[model samples]
Target: MNYTPWDLVLDAGFLSALLIVGILLRARFKMVQAMMLPASIIAGGLGLALGPHALNVIPFSDQFGSYAGIINGVVFASLPFAGSFSFRGKLHGARKMWAYSVSTYVLQWGLGLLFAIIILGQFFDLPDGFGLLLAAGFVGGFGTAAAVGSSMEAAGWADASTLGFTSATIGVLVGVVGGLALARWGVKKGHAKLATSLAEIPQDMRTGLVPVVSKREPIGHGTTSEGTVDPLTLHIGIVAVVTAAGYGVGLGIEALWGVKVPLFATAFLTGMAMRLLLDLTPARKYVDGTTVKSISGTATDLLVAVGIASIVPSIVMSYALPLALLLAFGVVYCVLIFRFLTPRIFKDGWLERGLFTWGWATGAVATGLALLKVVDPKSKSGTIEEFGIAYVGFSPVEILMAIVAPFAIIAGLSGQFIVATIVLGIGLIFVALMGGGRADAGNRANSFSNVAP
Candidate 1:
């Protein structure tokens, strides 16, 4: 618990070294690029190999495990600053995407709880809310892994963060490695509408380098004069303010209610209030969405690397057998969910989009997009565009699951939560398959719901 400034500096140096190495591998190796492996994953992987959990060479600070939860606060805090969530018009395609995504998301959580209570809990000595790790890592990624792990620790599960990160790491591997093989099968089956073969991918993409011709737009616009305040600094300041407010709110709630809350949720609520206050003044115009988003990405990258590097190997090994079984169920179940639900949800680009969703279900959205790039190289399927619109609506549901599930487990309401999630997922599926009409209804006979969100 006692440390100096030098401890912080060394940890930063080690993490930065691992990140740079990951970047270099992605840039220099065609195989790495082909798998669409983000530098964060590569960095996290290497960090684990070199840190105390494995070789004990990096000399990371005792505080390393805590960084992910701290940085993840920024990710959540910046959410509302980016702007309102809307679906534009009822693009029927967006409905299907929302429906498909929510159905799977809820079901995954429900199934995870079921596995924890009915199966794993019966066989192994597990902590409360142990089953929720599947969706926490697989669907939530390292961002949620850190937050969920932190929350569980507060609720008396000390090793939850390590297990969550480990689950997320495995999910990413399955997404990247298994996804490529699935892509090949899609192409061979003639279901991939655009790309014919994996070998046809362009050179720049294969090396993780964009050409000069592709660098057409600036990442962000400057609204403030540099003498007064830098634009990036303004965005970062906003994010920091939200993170701090969330932490204060968290402490206040704990004092009043006697239960710890999820930091990400509190940060998000704080950001929402801040965003509204900014909108009342001219300050809203200066809150650059792009710059704030960039800061989030940067923090997320560090969070992933640290999350993996800080895993406690002895704890992981203690529960290794049951843990492996849970992850194996996660991998196969995600694929099965995609196969069964996709055709019912998407009429066009089913194969390409389904494969993309599978990657997302397993781990990261970037991994899903990578699979999409390979299967629909031309971007002709419009999967990403539809998902963008769909996400506007689906996001709150994701936040709800993240906040509610573990608390339910700790409160001994796992059965009720699991049943609610399963029922919600099934109901959403029906809403996807049947319907009312909202889009083009005046012009035609059917509503958007008649056909799908």
Candidate 2:
């Protein structure tokens, strides 16, 4: 059957209806608010339960899953222009933050592989590249899950996306819920600073509306007059061009070398080149990084809903036990990084910083931001500021990990790749320790309860 634009429009209509309902539920239900669930997840869950998989009521097409791959290409490719993701924030705790952030990223890649090799593969029949799913899904969230899952599928793993999305779904839930638990624990232990109680988090965080003028933030600056070209359209056009060009490059590689390259990597590389070229020209003035990032976020919200709704129930069921074990191990590993690792890595604001990293290290950057907002609503903890500066070092290594791991596993270099992650993780830990943070920072803060908020 031909996929008409009308089909897309219809599917979008269904998802949009679900999104509206989800937003209403979030706004009206205190339980949903207490859980801090994103509207997209709620929308996706409704889509999943009501669509083809369960009740077959909504009539979403078979084309649902592919949207995640296509849209995530935009999400990741837009990173090069993420002005707010920042390479210019204050450098107060930048070194220590970089070490912890980079290490968490690298080590998750390694640990996921180690899980496959040491335990999961020995007992069950799985794809050789199967281990990458844990790290891909849990560490980087849905966008990276889509990228890595798509890459692994291209490498001959058939059930990759289903498993990867499953990991991501669980990751976000645990990262948020467990993160809040950790925050409370931190407060009881006298480690928390400003976030004394989760109940005290602003009501507006639960409802996505800006109730007053003072609470509103600009979406982005208009660089072009609407009479000529809308700024939003212009930004989307730029992202589309970059993503399409990257897709073309990927096709070119496959035609020449008989190899399938992941579109996300190619897209990021293309975005980087385009950003550089624009930087050298006067055209840079017309491009707004924040606006481009907004486009990415828009794509992400849709992709999350679509991705969850498209999960192959049988595939997930078949791999259920292995999924459970892998996720359990991954969750424990990430929690330890938050509990034992990052606290020692951050000299000050360990409670807040560690909690944020726990969210990011397991989920996505947004998860970190969500958790951070609850704790440091005014953004006083300096976590994101440090992250902005540290992101300069973080981006390349992250892209490299996404590029290398699947191919390495396919080539049977899993052992060597695992070793490399260990070495990198150890090196990053040493860097964090040497970067001016006290090794005992986690245990030193016992009087935080006495401090005034």
Listed in order, each prediction's TM-score against the native is: 0.93, 0.93
Give me candidate 2's TM-score against the actual structure. 0.93
* Candidate 2 clashes between residue pairs 3 or more apart in a chain or in different chains: none
Per-residue CA lDDT of model 1 for 1-453, tens digit only, reads 687888888889888988889888989987787777778888888888888778987778877777788888888998887757555664455676788788888988889878877889888988868888899999888887887788888888889999999988888988888888888888898878678889776665676667677664566789899999888887888899999999999999999997788788799899988888988998788888887777888888898888888888898999899889888888878878767667656654578778888889988888898788888776666677667767888888887777888778778898899899999999988887763332321221133233232
lDDT of 2 by residue, 1-453 (tens): 788898899999999999999899988998898878888989988998998888999988778778888888898778888763244433333567777788888888888878877899899988887778888888778887888888888977878988888888888899889988887788888776666666667778877656889978777889999999999999989999999999999999999999998889889889988888988999998999788878988889998888888888889999999888988888899878888877676645787788788887777787788787766766666666567666776877777788888888878899999999989888989987777534232233323221111
